[model samples]
Target: MSLVSALAIYFIIWWMVLFAILPIGVVTQEEAGEVTPGTESSAPGRPQLLKKALLTTLVAGVLFAGIYWLRVHSGLTLDDLPFKPPSAR
Candidate 1:
């Protein structure tokens, strides 16, 4: 893939991994028994966003590296997908 395409793919993967990582080790206000005034009980007591962001970056980098290796070295292409458009068929 081109540089822009590679970057776009990595961006998408990063967001996906971030969402997956966001809920890990979460402690809701209700769970912690420390709901702050005016905040929902369901809200996290401590979001730990910086930690999760770092974890997400690490996980996404590994996933992207695997994907990049497959794209460059595994000889895979669009043709490897199981489906085809009607026109192509």
Candidate 2:
């Protein structure tokens, strides 16, 4: 692929990462647990939920960076079909 196409792909992924970290609207406690509002069960669950979300984001960033590095430097991925055909083997 051309340099422009490769850079565009990277830029698109960066935007996706940014959106994953931020959102448009707020989800109330009740909405998160799928229960009615003003309920006791949803109140204490937010901390745990936030913790999980942050951890997921951190892991995703690291994983994406690693994959990007591999693509930019090493010749791997679907774009590089290194496998030989059966006849060649």
Q: Pick the candidate with the highest TM-score.
A: 1
Worst 10 residues of 2 by lDDT: 41-50
Using all chains and alpha carbons, the TM-scores for the candidates as numbered come to 0.87, 0.38
Q: lDDT by residue for model 2 over 1-89, one digit each (tens)? A: 56687567656665676566544244656667665556764344344446556655675667666777787678677857676666953
What does candidate 1's lDDT look like per residue over 6-72, in tens digits? 9999999999999999989999999999999999999999999999999999999999999999899
Please identify model 1 stretches exceeding 4 Å from their true place: 84-89
Candidate 2 residue-wise lDDT at 70: 81
